[model samples]
Each structure stands twice: as structure tokens, then as C-alpha cells.
Target chain A: MKFGPMKPQRRNRLLLVLFVVLAAASAVGLALSALNENMNLFYSPGQITAGEAPTGVVIRAGGMVVAGSVLRATESLRVDFVISDLQGADVNVSFTGILPDLFREGQGVIARGILGRDGNFVAEEVLAKHDETYMPPELVDVLPDSHNDPETFKGGTRQ
Target chain B: MRFFSLPDYQLIMLNWFHRLGAPRSFYEISGRLLPVLWVLSGLSILTGVIWSLGFVPEDYQQGNSVRIMYIHVPAAIVAQSGYAMMAVAGAVFLIWRIKIADVALQCAAPIGASITFLALVTGAIWGKPTWGTWWVWDARLTSTLVLLFLYLGIIALRSAMENRESAGRATAMLALVGVVNLPIIKYSVDWWFTLHQPSSFSLGEKPAMPAEMWIPLLVMVLGYYLFFFTLWATRMRVEILNREFRTDWVQRLVVGS
Candidate 1:
């Protein structure tokens, strides 16, 4: 059997269908772009420190927990740690609850609460964020400095 | 008539395509294809599971929990690709009014939904130990949840409509609309600040993990694709036979078998 050309009527319908699909896709794309900032899970320390994030209202700030910045209270569940963007901006987060299992020095964390007038972030809850890369203990031990390098794990900050 | 004539091979390809659109032809082709697919998928999945759980080393940070990636990542990957395939089938059905295309779309929804659910559940399980939270409404996680809902929504939409013809067209339109979410799910991590990290593997770039880690993952991913195709084709064949049971070919095949 010989292959035949599409009828003009059918060809018009195909073009109309393609046009509808493209138009719908672009509409959704525009809507998503408009809602982009609201879709972010948390604010980076850089944003918060720059006053880009609103103060006194409940908000979430996230970054790597600065190494050696954690201070635990002896009698209470209260803990204070500085989360940093690792590019100079830092925010102090004070929480009075149990931290998540992955919460540790140099680990990425998101704290939810209020930013105080004193520039301290009073966190009601804290959640850790893990990077995508994975390696064995032996491999990690071989390159201990790599883990400590902020450049290796820039996924911690939003910006 | 004004368009240039097709070559012999092109004509042959077009003939084969048109024939495959018929349920009887598809049934015969799939009957010969199913056994090979099932055996290969089974072997690949078995090897992949054993290799991932026992042979691969634990992550330095996440330890044993990192093993969840073998299932979680593959499920997510297959689930997204499944939706894309379903949408393509929907488009074909819409454009050509092909019965087999609609049948394929109908059969794929539930399986795709189940796989998407697996991805979400396994993700939450893995997140608890490694991310310190069971769930977070981050861009990546939220987009994936939307994907699961889209699958369920499609299935529900199909069942809700009484007319087969209108249901097929409606579901096709819905599937096409939701196709926009696939790219959102993929780029959410990179596009926005989310608790979920960016993908470890990307086309045209070196994988973030070492060869030892990614090799088994690659195997598991391919195995999952094979497994999905095996299940999809099996479901398609069963549905085709059920829809065509009154036809002579189907009755004769049933009696002969």
C-alpha cells in the first residue's frame, strides 16, 4: 500500500492540537515562575541577614550548622547553634527541643521560627538537609578535608 | 498529492505501524515478546537487589540507610518516565482515535500511580534518618507529591466518566495538562531552595558518586525500567484480550491454548 498525505482537514486539526498543548504548557510555566519564591522551603542565612526575610513573623532559615558554634544548656533541652551560608553571612538559631538525628556540626539544617530584634533566630523546630553525594567511610577518611570544605557541599544554602 | 512520495522502507514502516495499532497484531507480537521480557526483568532485578543490599558499601554519613536510594531513586525515575509514556499514548489516542492507544493509557495509570506511591513512601522512610525529618514540603518533594496526585486523579477521572469515548478523550487531555509537572519535578531541586538535594546523576555530566556506588544504581535503574515495561505489556495484553474476546482471533487463540 502506498503511503498517502494527511487530508487538509486532519492537518488543520493536528496544528490546532499542537497549538493548544504549547499554549497550556507556557501558561503553567508562567504561573510557576511567579510562585517561585513562595515555593522555596526556607530562606538562606544570606537572605535573612540581609533583611530580605521578614522579622518577628514565623519563618524558616536554613544553612550549614557552623562547626563549633553549637552550645547546649546543661539543665534544659535548649540548644543554640549558628547556621551560616559559609560566605560570611551567619544567623543564630536557638531551639528548645530535640534536634533531628542528622543535625550536627557542619551539617545542613533548616530552622522554623521567628527572627528576633536582636538578630537571633528563635527556632521552634529544626530539620536537617542531606546532600546528594554519597561515599564510603574509607573514601571519606581518605579525603577528610573535602567534607570540611564548604565548596564541596554548597547545596546547604539557597543562593 | 503535492507532498513527495515516501521511499519503500518508509512505506513498509508505515504499514507495520498501522498493523500494530490493531489489537490482534499486538496480541500476537506481545505473546512472543512477554516470556523474554519477564525472564530478563526478573534476573536483572534479582541481581540488582542482591548487589545493592549486600555488595555495595554504606554511605559515610547516612550509613546503611543510603541503600534506600536503590529502590527510591529507581521508583521515582520509572514513575516519571511512566507518566511521560502514558501522556504520549494519550496524545496518540487523541490524534488518531486508536483503540490500542486508549487501552494502553488505561492500563498504565494504576501501575504508574503505584510506582509513584512507592517513590514517595520510600523517600519519607529514607528522609527520617538522613534528613532528620519524615517529610518536608520542599519544591522537589512537593512536586513529586503533585505527581502522585496527578496519577490518582487520572485514574479517578477515567472511572468517573460513564461514556468510554468521552472518558478516553478527557483523560487524554488531563494527562497532557499534567505533563507540565514532569519537568517541574525534575528541576525543582536546582530551581529552588529545597530540603531535597539535586540529583546525583545528570546526562552529559560525570555522576556525583563514585563508580562503585553509581554502577549498582545504574543497574537497578535499568532493571526497574525493564520490570515496568514487563508489567505494562502484560497488563496491556490482558486488557486487549478482554476487550477483544468476542473476536475470532481471540476466541481461536483461547481455544487453541
Candidate 2:
């Protein structure tokens, strides 16, 4: 079996450079296309209420869980809760699973699922959105008049 | 236009790259540094793991499952950066014909692949409790899986080639081509709404977690890096010995041992 030349000539160097450049360009093109199809940006309750969110598409709707809005079924795991954008618009979310330990009224939550025909956010998954020490910035940003005083915000309670 | 117009500082840096690219120099220098790296890795990882598991307060939400972050996050961070380092070595081998760079690239792939696998497995375990699913085809998860495959591909390509020089060149090219996936993995969470949360750590920004939680995580990250370097140096030494089996230094060392 013959081995390729170890020493790289100018032509071989140029070829390698060209190959790398072309490969990178094609990879970026492919990535952008995949991203176009797969990108699922989170929307606020305001966006959902204003019809900015696409119907029947898997997307994230995030906001503060409205106080006194949690309704858990006695016989089943189904739960209904309303999340507020802090701008007077609220999106009703229905989830059929055990809520995370952090799930609570007045806490920030993000629901992932498609919007139902009845305009309810049918959440396949619900995630409580806060770190050990700080609330997620998205939640903090949507809290009404509390962005300036995030420390006082209900969801900003440090553990 | 000047065909090669590198600044003085860059030229000086290039000289160091060339000098260090020699296998003998790399072996000698890394041999001197290996013990320190081993000690650092062992000590820091031990301390960090203990601190995180035993001392830090449980997460407000995830509870004990959150302890997995100590290993999960560090493994993921190191796995991604390891690929970046391997690609840089691959480029050096290709552009400068550095034999030691090829060794570095080869040694790094298996370690990176293992770390990437660890990241994926730990991530899945963490998700089981937090996200209520063992796996999701989220952007971050999918891109990271791609990264693991890229590492495996480079490893397989090198082993399959019959000629050593051709093998190095082939794997180097593959490694360079795979570099595009790194940035995609980094930004996947930001670019797409994913079940995987965005990174809690960022440069020049205060960490979202408290000091008690993040400090141990920082230590763990450092430990993982040191661990990679320790293993990398050890692997490179073995490669150097294999390549220089006919040389007098290795013969004398073997006889002396």
C-alpha cells in the first residue's frame, strides 16, 4: 500500500484551505435551515392573547402564575392555572401531570405545548422558572411595575 | 500586499508554537507538568464534589436531583471546550505539520467523546426528575448529540486509515470541519425555546446561582479541565514513546526503569 506524501506543497495547502472554507459554509447553511424549522421561541401571555403565537405549534408560554388561579382535579392529576403577563392579559394553561415541587401560585412558570382550539394553552410540560438565588430574567421582565423592584417581586424569593 | 504580514508579537507566538510542536519538547515539558495537573485534578474534584453534595443547600425546586448539576454542567462545559481544543490542535497539525499536534488531536478525541457521553447521560438523568422526561429532541440536546458523533467520527477515521500520515491528515480535516458545530451547540438554547435551560454561567456576568452553589460548580469545572490535561499529557507521553521506540532516550529510559 502506498502512503500519501508527508510534505505539503503549496497546492495541497490551498486545497485544504478551500475544503475547510467550503465545509464551514455548507455546515452553516444547513444549520440555519434546521434552525428555521425547529426554532421555538417563548411567548408572553400578551403575545398569546394578541394572536401573535401560532396555533397548534409547540411553543413556550411564560409568565407569573396568577394568584388564586390554580384548580387541581380531585380525582385526577389534571390541573388548570392562569399565567399573567403583568400587562392585564392572562393565558389559561391546562396541564395533566404532577406539578414540579416549585409550582405555586404567583411563581413564574413556562408551559410547553400547543394552543388548543378553545384558546387554552394545553401544556405537555410545565417548568418552574427560577434559579436558586434569582428569578429568570424573562419572568422578571414581564412582572408589572416590578422590573424596577425585582427584589420585591413574588417570584424573586431567594431559596 | 505582503504575502505573510503577521505582526511581531504573532511571529514570536508562532515561533513558540513551532518549538513546542516538536514531540520531544512536548514530551519533556508535559512530563514536568503532569504531576501537578494530576494532584490538582484529584484534589479539586474531590473537594468540589464533596462540597456540592454534602454542604450546599438543596435546590428550591429540584431538591436532591439538583446535585447532579455539579457533574452534569462541568462535564458538558469540558466536553464542548475539549472539542474546540482538539480542532485547534488539528489545525496546527495541518497548517504547520506538527507531529505532536496530531498526537494531541488523537489523544483528545477519545477523552472528549467520553466526556460528551457523560454529559448526555447525566443530562438525561437530571431531566428525568426535573423535566419529567428522560429525553427530548430539544435543540440543545440534539446539537450536543451531534457533537458526540463528531468526536466519535474523528476517532474512527484515524483508526481506519492504514497510513499514519494520511490518517492524521484525514482526522485533522474532519476535526476542523466539525468546528462549526461548536458554536451551534453553545447558542442552541438561546436561539430556540428548549426544555434544557440556558446556561447559568457566563463571563463578565454575575452567576444566577448563589455563591454556595456556583462556587463548587466553578471548582468542579476547573477540576474537570485539569483532569483532561492530566489524561491528555499521559496519553501524549505514551504516543511519544511508541513513535520514538527506536530513539536512544526511550531505550535508556526503559533500561533505566
Docking class of 1: medium
Residue runs of model 1 more than 4 Å from their true location after superposition: A1-5, A144-159, B1-12
Taking the tens digit of each residue's C-alpha lDDT, what string does model 1 give over B1-257? 52247777876787788788989898788889989988888888888899999999988888899999999999999999999999999888887778999998999999999999999999999999887778988888988999999899999999999999999999988888889899989988877888887788888987877899999888888888998988898899999989899998889888995
| TM per candidate | 0.93, 0.80
Candidate 1 backbone collisions, by pair:
none
Candidate 1, Cα interface RMSD: 2.8
Task: Report how far off residue B28 is in candidate 1 (Å).
Answer: 0.8
Which CAPRI tier for candidate 2?
A: incorrect
Model 2 stretches with alpha carbons more than 4 Å out: A1-15, A18-26, A41-64, A84-89, A106-114, A123-159, B1-19
* Model 1 chain B: lowest-lDDT 10 consecutive positions: B1-10
**Per-model TM-score of chain A alone?**
0.85, 0.59
The digit string of per-residue lDDT tens for model 2 on B1-257 reads: 34157677866776766667777777788888888899999999999999989987776556687889999999999999999999888887787677898999999999999999999999888877776567767678988999999999999999999999999999988888888888878887666555566677778987766677788889999999999989988998999899888998889888995
lDDT of 1 by residue, A1-159 (tens): 233677676667667667767888899899987887788888888888788888999998888899999999999999999998798889999999988877889988889999998899999989888777789888976754544435422433333
Q: Tens digits of per-residue lDDT for model 2 on A1-159?
A: 112354556447757756895789697868686666345446767767878778988887877788899999999999999988566778899999988766777766778899976779999888765433433233444545322212212221112
Backbone clashes for every candidate come to 0, 0
Q: After superposition, how far is residue B65 of candidate 1 from its true place, in Å?
A: 0.4
